[model samples]
Target: MTTMFRKALNALPRLGVQVVDLGPGAAVISRRGRYSATKVSADAWMVGGGRRSTRAPAEGWGLRKAAASSLCARHVADFLANYEVNCVFDVGANRGQYGRQLRESGYRGRIVSFEPVPDALARLRKAAERDPDWWVRPVALGRSESVQSMHLGWKTMNSLLEPSAYGQQRYKRFADTRTTQVQVRRLDKVMDEALHGIANPRPFLKMDTQGFDMEVFAGAGERLDEYVGMQSEVAALQLYEGSPHMTEALAAYEEAGFGITGLYPVTREETTGRVVEFDCVLARVSSVPGSAAGVRP
Candidate 1:
């Protein structure tokens, strides 16, 4: 009887039902799906052939509470099927969420990830442990190789190599924060070593290192040829706080034998009150003569 009840419950659309199995005298039931903060009293509810005590949905007991939970996973799956990409370099890998997402979406290729934060790097490593194609590195990529003090944000979400005074101040609004000294390496050196002795290296690089995207390319130098395409986070609003402007950054790509092929807006105007908080510029390396012969602008 209990097995039948469990099967029936599982068959129901897993929208907002948190089912807990407690032996005999105790069973706890809570809402699943969407995140919320509310308390409800436990009571007995009838199921299959038994009556067990469970907490009603914090709001109420009905399917109406589950309407907001959309099938986002399906959409993401569709996207992965349609997009054609091979090698992926995830800069600012954080906890390797993007890497995991790629794998889950059936992306079977080399995935190189970089994370400067020690704690975050640890988590990223654990997350990618099962994936052999996922490579995680702990060095921060910049224009030069040097030890730099990075500002640690409250929840690892706001950590940045170049945090603005305003950003720091805003971060202080919350407690529980710490800073650490991290090693910074030049992308030029890293890429040269990674692509060394290889006949043809065509990798897709995605960079999101707060305000240090331009410096990363600066370090890539001539080896930027190994990367056929790239997506970099360009901070227009934070440009005044040390980030290079979009125009200047794109010019650097042009000098490096790359052309701006696409742009994706990260933060919209309705949320940030700015034209575009973060811009993802897609660049492709030129294959023409004298393309790789000039210095970055």
Candidate 2:
């Protein structure tokens, strides 16, 4: 099919045509016009040009949004609405997937996304280009500040920790062990700068740093209390060496006064159908400085 499309493109008149590869799921070629490519499913692409519909085709981040809205977006939306969240610190925001889902869920608050991978960061920046409230930081948040080697995994599965042997076998597609050095910072150190001009910053944290969610949370230090709600990826089976277990991470959050709001499965073991990880949503019900006092609706 791609060959036929290329042949057709070659036969077209050189009428100042331009082509843009809109990431893995879509591509667009136009001559003073616009086109859209929607990923209807994992292996399908639907391309269209100029259209108006009550429900537009999912493209790029919209594809991710559609996929997430079906799973955890509703819960996340309720978290934001319930807590009156004003800003979101999207830790490990690969290509702004979480941010896009936030927008899709009708949360128009500020989004500060942090990512380290070069290619993913490029796509993430592009996705946030037009949104003044969406900010992208090309750095990984961790327990400390330093330059660390990030283990490259499949898609958004890259991590600061090495992949475990069982993890490698269980997720063969994520077994690529390439490494890239990226800047790592403690969130507390950069918090002021990231939220400089934002007023009444009732922050919500959506952490999906592969298996390093706890480290990112640890990096928040005393500033951790500034967030009203959080979503962390908890691994039931260790996917990354040195990653905290599900119980340990959950206990830590509970110890920090966060109560469970929801637990959404992220992946399941194929053979046993057992959950491998979960998107653990938690909220602080107590009145805090970041929420319930002058926070915007």
Best by lDDT: 2
- Give per-residue CA lDDT, model 1, range 1-297, as digits (tens): 567656755655476666545444444455543323222113323232122325444333321122111122223233333333446777778888778876776778677888988778899999989887678889888788898876676454434445556555444533445678888888766764454444545566777776777877777777777665676767665522677777787777777766765454454333344534443435453432235632233
Whole-structure CA lDDT of model 1: 0.59
TM-score per candidate? 0.61, 0.74
lDDT of each: 0.59, 0.80
| Candidate 1 off by > 4 Å | 1-86, 156-162, 165-177, 192-199, 269-273, 279-281, 285-297
lDDT score for residue 41 of model 2: 42
Which lDDT tens digits does candidate 2 get at residues 133-152?
Answer: 99999999999999999887
Give, for candidate 2, the lowest lDDT window spanning 10 residues.
57-66
- Candidate 1 least-lDDT 10 residues: 62-71
Candidate 2: deviation at residue 118, Å?
A: 0.3
Model 1 residue pairs with clashes: 188-219
For every model in order, what is the number of clashing pairs?
1, 0
